[model samples]
Target: MSQLMSIDTFLDSEEVLVDVRTPSEFLKAHIPKALNIPLLTDQERAEVGTLYRHKGKEKAVLKGLDLVGPKMSDIVRSFLEVAPKRTVRLYCWRGGQRSQSVAWLLEQAGFKAKILKDGYKSFRRWVLNHFEREYQFRVLGGYTGVGKSDLLQILENKGAQVLDLEKEAHHRGSAFGGIGLPKQPSTQHYENKLAMRLRAFDMRLPIWLEDESRLVGKCAVPEFLFQQISRAQLFVVCRTIEERIVRLCQLYGVEQKQSLIDACMRIKKRLGLEHTKKAISLIEAGLLDEATLIILKYYDKKYQYSIDKRVVSLYLNGSEMSDVQLAERLLNR
Candidate 1:
């Protein structure tokens, strides 16, 4: 018979792991590196759940078995193809029924299938706990056009440990975030990339991270990292709107002018069609200052909202210091 182990134990072992949760559940979140092989088709899983609630567990279980029985051979074959040659760990939502059933079937087929005791819920708890541990962080906070990315490049040159969350998420973290960026990773891939980055950092030193939201582009930030950002200390950079507008224009350049115009136009309903139209005219007329002023009110308010809601510690921008000096104070503070 195959053994059942806690999620921690399974993770500790040098073996492949499979997550048997439905694709939707797996997409929202899952153990890093676990392959998904759902026991039920999405529709069938919904139907069984509906039956279980309206009818009875006995009826649902019977129907579930009937649905899965005919596909058992194919499921086993697919599992064999993905499962490690030596040993494999399997888990479902709670480790009681679905995972155990799958493990027993795999064991009967002469494979070492270890079920994750307490399953994915337990693993999620572990991820949450890890984030609660006290770790130093070097925050990168700036206004919409302060050239934080460029500063990050300088910081990297100076050998500071940094995690470019925007780069990793393939998002710029704004209404125009998707412009000039690759397609965003799925939420699962985002979490996996985050975990990989965190693992590479030295826990003793501060890890540099940009100010970001719970969602970057199409992907939601992992629950753990979201919590960290909420509690982590912050450093703010300031620059004149003119400096920012020039930098934005240079960074985005002519290639993205039409896309920028479209992004501004889409905001018409929110900013009022009159105001949005004026902003568009400013862009078209090369009156970037006018366009920037209008956008600043909208974007600045949004930034303030996040800071207030997330309970971030604010460091006001210094007027006297140079950008490099401002960055140093923020990082060292």
Candidate 2:
């Protein structure tokens, strides 16, 4: 007999997690570490869905059985490889027929299979609702090249609760952020990953986050969490333009010059045509520091505009303080 369990119970258990949704569905968003053992292919699921809408549930059931019959042995073999313990936990989009069917099949094959009570949909609800919970957020606000991300990493190593949103999004929250990063996860998946991390955090401790606009590349910060960040304590870091230019050159200088130019062109409208051309010319001349200074004009102005709208809790001059010293101040504050 298959048992249905709450999402919390499923998360706490160490059983092999199986997602029986189609590959496309799994790709968009899924529980972390859940293996894809799709009961139907993308096309097959679509075909069945269309039939169910046009025909009745009886005809749809018959069609589904016909399609799945030949694949039973293969499914069993695949499950056996991943589930050496012969114990499994699985879910579909909803705790519907597809998951129930798979659970029944596994049971008949002499395996213990438990189903997630409301399936992936329930997990998603769990993910979204997590952002609404209260958190003590410490937002690190600074202009480009101020080393905010670096400091956040140090804080994490010092045992502070930190949410590295850029790491999760594979973006640094800048026009050039995506130049050398891995492909960004879909926004849905980004939320899923963030929620998973948040679930493991101790809520009593302050969560350090790099200040960002709502969107990081293609991923939008969950709205409720973003609101909390906005109202939470803000710490701004300031550094000289020359200092920032040197840091920017060091970070981006190794990338292909063409890639750098393409990044500049992306913000051409905001950067202005004349400034954009000068930045491109500097890049071609291998004067990365000069190019960065030009780009910083736009970014610095934009950052200051955002900072002006918020009440800053503290400001640290990066020119005077080492990153280690600054981190200590933040940690001890």
Candidate 3:
């Protein structure tokens, strides 16, 4: 006899959260920091699902048992190794057989195991609902190379709530975005991360975020999130084109030459072949300043297009001062 619980019931509890869904499903999105102790492998789960659809529940249960029998001891060992408290909360796709069966097994092994009332699907619903709520977002908008990411970090250090979308997405929102970073999370996982971050913030205070397109690398910002940011207070960080170009070079100059050239080539159609060739040549020749200048012109136009589309609330001149000075001004406001 196990207790059925909602995700919120134990999300911050001392009990360990174990996702009993298959690894692939867990990888796409699971409760943040939840351990994956799958009740079935991807192939096994598929087989069970097919059997359930065509044959019947009895056949599927039998097959699932067969697949899980040999792994029972291993599962127990893994669960205990990770959960020192001897209490575990389990969930699968929809609080279905997989999670129930795991709960039974864990309980039999002398660990207190509870199942989520509606499982991971329920958690996902909670996540989506978070975005649907109205929020007062303090947006930090700027052209490319305005050091917005650095400023967001500064704001965070000063106790302001800041969501670094680029950092979370492991991208800088450009062709050169992936130059030196880990692989970005799947869109599903990215949203999961965002939902977690959203809950952590105090809604009474303004939440700071960088203005971004719907897309960041391979990850797309959820529609409700994009909508709120669009409607929120929008402020631009103004910087000189020359300064932006210099900043771009500082950021990308240490990157490998081939990486820079590949990034340029990625936008060849937009850059035009002649400009692309010139940019690549300059980068290869170690004249990174000249190379970045050409790329900045293209980026500046693209950013201006974004600006033109938005109803900007204010534009803060940050070119003449250090990021720290700019951060102080924004904080006072």
Candidate 4:
């Protein structure tokens, strides 16, 4: 028989985490490092769920068996191919039938597969609760195009514990944030990734993170983490508007003319229709610098409004130093 492993034991072990949930479920959110080897396909799970609703428990079980039984030997063989040492850690959505069945089949095939207690939901709970703990946070705050993200990366290169949340969310936290990035993960999955990243750091040392509003594209920062960010030590980088506009154009100076116009259109209500029209026209005319100025007028004002709400602990004239120099100065102090 396969062994039943507690979440802690499974975590402490060296075995690979194999998720047995459907591909759709695994794609939405999953425990980090989990290799998905679904016991049932997406359609099969839906069919089984529909069967359970009206055909009674026994009928549902039989239907699930009918769907999965054909793939049993192939599944076991594929898992062994991933874990050649005959050891594996398995889980499903709620740690019920799917993982248990897979564990049994794997054990029958001479593999010592262990099922995670309470499955992925347990890990989700653990991560959600992880945000409640206190950690020393040093926030790098600045207006748009102030190069805060670049400085954060510099700090990381210099051995500082930095949490690049934009990197995590694949966004720069603006109307144009998602332009060049892949689709954002759901907020739940973002929290899961954030929690996993936090676990690697020593909380005693101040974690350097870029100041972010709660929403990054579609992903929202967890409430506890957001509260921490709101109250953390702030390092505001002060740079000139002209300099910031130069940097913004450098960061977003892409050849995708339509994309740039569409991104600007997203904030048309806030930017005003006249301003938006002018910006789009400038972009169409190959005048990115002029278009950049128009957009920055709106973004800068909006960012200033947000900054006005926060207490600035310190403001550093970032124009005086390179990003690496700024990073070193901030960390050394």
- TM-scores, all candidates, are 0.70, 0.96, 0.95, 0.95
Error of 1 at 328 (Å): 9.3
Mark the regions of model 1 whose C-alpha exceeds 4 Å error after superposition. 50-59, 84-86, 150-170, 180-202, 213-233, 238-243, 250-262, 265-275, 282-294, 297-333
* Winning model by TM-score: 2
- Every candidate's lDDT: 0.76, 0.93, 0.88, 0.88
Error of 2 at 118 (Å): 1.2
TM-score of 4: 0.95
lDDT of 1 by residue, 124-205 (tens): 6666555556667767677788878766766766777888888888888877778888888777667656765666578998
Q: For model 4, state the Cα shift of residue 26 in Å.
A: 1.2
Candidate order by decreasing TM-score: 2, 4, 3, 1
Q: Rank the candidates by lDDT, best first.
A: 2, 4, 3, 1
Query: How many clashing pairs in candidate 1?
Result: 0
Across residues 53-94, which tens digit of lDDT does each residue of candidate 4 receive? 988889999998999888898898889889999899899988
Give the alpha carbon lDDT tens digit for every residue of 1-333 in model 2: 998999899888889999999999999988988999999999999888898999988888899999999999999999999998889999999988989999999988999988999899999999999999999999999999999998998899888999999999999888899988999999999999999999999998899999999999989999999999999999999999888888888888889999999999999999999999999999999988888888998999998899999999999999998988899999999
The RMSD of every model to the true structure, in order and in angstroms, is 5.2, 1.4, 1.6, 1.5
Of candidates 4 and 3, the better by lDDT: 4
What is the per-residue lDDT of model 3 for residues 161-277, given as tens digits with 9 covering 90 to 100? 988899889999899998988999999888888888988888888888898889998999999789888888888999987888888888888889999999999999999899999
**Of models 1 and 3, which has the larger lDDT?**
3
Q: What is the model-wide C-alpha lDDT for candidate 1?
A: 0.76
